[model samples]
Target: MATLRKRNGRWQVQVRRQGFPIQSRSFRSKADANEWARLIERQQDRQELGPDRKALKSITLAHLVARYRDEIVPQKRGSAVETILLNRFLRYPICQKTLNDLTTADFAAYRDQRLKEPKHRSDKPVTPKSLKRELSPLSHMFRHAVVEWEIPLRNPLDGLKLRVVDNKRERRLLVGELDRLLESTKKGRNKLVAPIILFALETAMRRGEILTIQFRHVDFGRLSLVIPESKSGYSRVIPLTRRAVAILEALRLEDAKPTDLAFPITPIALRLQWDRLTARAGIDGLNFHDLRHEAISRLFELGLTVPEVASISGHRTLAQLMRYSHANQETVRTKLQGPETGESSHH
Candidate 1:
């Protein structure tokens, strides 16, 4: 079950547990070597080592990230976001490290290094909000590591505090910005992005959901689209507004097959086009996700209740939904005026 042998003038633990290659470093003391072999053998006897560290220590973070990207993230609506973060943030730094070598200090160092990087090869500093978003997936991965893989003792993220992200809610178009953006979308080389932008603003759906939508998922009669796998693994049916329906109707591909994707663009391509659109629109520091915020704010301005907004946005909690409904100081004063004057029933 366990064997200790002399190698390079030191005793090494060598054990083959149920076809696994269990080999460890050569220890200077024979007693230390024997104890490690015995403990591992006992864990093997209990069927714990075989399922836990047998392959986990050998598995590199790159390997696990690839598996996670293909097997897990594909099933969620946030796949595109996760993919971007993995590629730009986690993948390069940790890919070479084994799972066992991922210490909290290493993660902290990554966070610090990311924060210090000039944004997008420019001299601009990386924001705390962006850094927080990058760290979000790692927390989930470590959770999966502990619960699913049975990695023993301590989550790397247990006590670490991430900076609070201060998000500026994008409410609506400012003056002629929307018209300019629409014109740019139509005349620009990336024409396919127009319908996607329209759909995102109308439905309040994420970019990933828009990219992966299939014709079969649309229910024309019910005026709703079903997302079978969302970020939360909870399937949801989102009711389409008239504008959304119109956009979809115009987007219907000529000679389209039933199985065809609504938009035939990859996530990376869509983002590239979005970058062009934003650059043309003269918008700065706004992401594709800000469009969702714009839509939710529009919903609130249209006098939709919180539940009504949440139904379309897929916000699981009230707190999540509230983050999108930011009213300007002028609007807040106007909204408070009627109540202060005792002239309105609605508060």
Candidate 2:
């Protein structure tokens, strides 16, 4: 409906309709006001140039998330992680609201509230890194809705700069820390943790990639393993070190099929086991991902080139690969001595 009123000596026209955002404009004359209102209403009636509130009102954010989780997420390499994130998103208060009622403020509020709370019962508040992952699915879902599903609503997450991305972790294993962590893992019921941790440091493979390994992918003859599906959405063949090959050999079962997953634990169980092992080891400020950083740093220290490290780690960009290549002072000191001639070690 269009209402015309004379305010401040100019005719003001306001268009109000259900399932449409309220729009107002001022015109010099009532004739012009009527014409503009007619055009806007007609255009809106034909469903042009605005979000479709009717469709949005009927579809809740939760519904959209469910659809995206079911239809789109399954095709991705990180489907399990994304599916978990989407389900966690569905429990948010804003998900109960229809897309018509959701504004950018809703998402902003969620970020603030979510950041204040500790996720998964940890004492520390949610880090920007984890929050980025939580919001990633929503960002992609909104884009898919707009482009593929023909949903007329603009993404609320767009322009909301809640995430400070890529907070690089420089945590590396301290002197004798690897041995201590392995000893602690030996006490745990998950017997594979020690070897898995060893394999992780040796190969620089992500936890997901490590967990999904099949027997057929490991070539005992070549001393290499193929990560058929890496986190980068591509298959990469990383040459296993002698230690990594030995770990695989110890874990390989005679009766196991080629299709069996090397590590039968779910990601959640692995996380829980890691937490326990870390606590038992008296380690602080360590994460499972840090092993990859340690591995990549070791690879660089071993005189491997950037391209060589990227091939093993499956990092698509140099920036990302460089993030994990933090070299320590000890490494630099060792390198400056010219191939362990014992010149710098005399101190």
Candidate 3:
């Protein structure tokens, strides 16, 4: 049953049932209030009043993001970085709207606004790759809300097209550049920078993987390192080259504990030292990650098959492995020209 009354020049409706909680709302006219009350009463009488429906009626996207950040983000591989990204998403206006009321158009509008917004630190327009990363958490949050939280609404991000372009990086190390970089690193504040760069080039290991290596995880006899934790959530063993082995051997301490970090440097410190080293070397546009690319390409040049390279690089698919395999143009040209056979043939 619903009771209708006039309160301060507005119509108020309150519906109460034997088993359902009292639901109330205010409307400008009595007819509107009656209509809303009838809808609620009808839903309740049909046994359709669920906790999910109640949550959908009251919870906002901001609340959902908060819940996801607390409950889900911590369990992820890069939780610290993800937490920061999620914090930025919480400040957007789209998060303020009720989840039930969110539509695909709202997400499309947010995507456009994000593409137009300049980065806070760089003051440059955010790239499509970055915007795609930012959208990942929101998309996952909506999926979680639907599957786990039992929210009765379609994900607004579903089937929404992103307007930004994705440009894949093809940067490779040039001849003589490596030597200059290594020489400059020897003069930098961090003496370990040179060896770290060399290790990355030799092993094709990521910065995080190299930094996180412990003494216990390394097998000097087998010349491989066991990555106990990785971004893919699977442990992999990376074979070490002679140069990589020599670098680790020189850094190994006789009295070092099993849990001691091999590199003994943080990612921030490595990045800072790298910047200084690159500037001193007069190198431009070469990121540390490019070393991995250079290494993978070198493996391919050495006649290693895709599966062989994938095993070493820990790449799950050949398609992903191909992204890192950038053969030098000169090398490709030489291969295309073929070996010089002095015998002249007349056709």
Q: Each prediction's Cα lDDT score?
A: 0.74, 0.85, 0.82
**Residue lDDT tens for model 1, 122-236:** 5887877877777777677766655565444245666666676675565466677667778889767766788888888899898778877888898877889988777666878
- Cα TM-score per model: 0.68, 0.78, 0.74
Candidate 3 Cα RMSD after full superposition onto the native fold (Å): 8.7
Candidate 1 local accuracy as lDDT?
0.74
lDDT of 3 at 75: 94
1-347 per-residue lDDT for model 2 (tens digits): 89999989999999976656778999999999999999998877556868656768899999999999999999987688789888888888888999989999998899889899986847889977778878888998998887677676777888787657765788889998898899998799988898889889999989988988988999989988887776656887888889888888788789989888887888878999999998999999899999998988888888788899898989888988766555744776766866655456555
Candidate 3 structure, TM-score to reference: 0.74
Residue 202, model 2: lDDT of 91
Superior by lDDT: candidate 2 or candidate 3: 2
Better of 1 and 3 by TM-score: 3
TM-score of 2: 0.78
RMSD of each: 7.9, 8.0, 8.7
- Give me the overall lDDT of model 2: 0.85
- Count clashing residue pairs in model 3: 0
In model 2, the Cα lDDT at residue 87 comes to 89
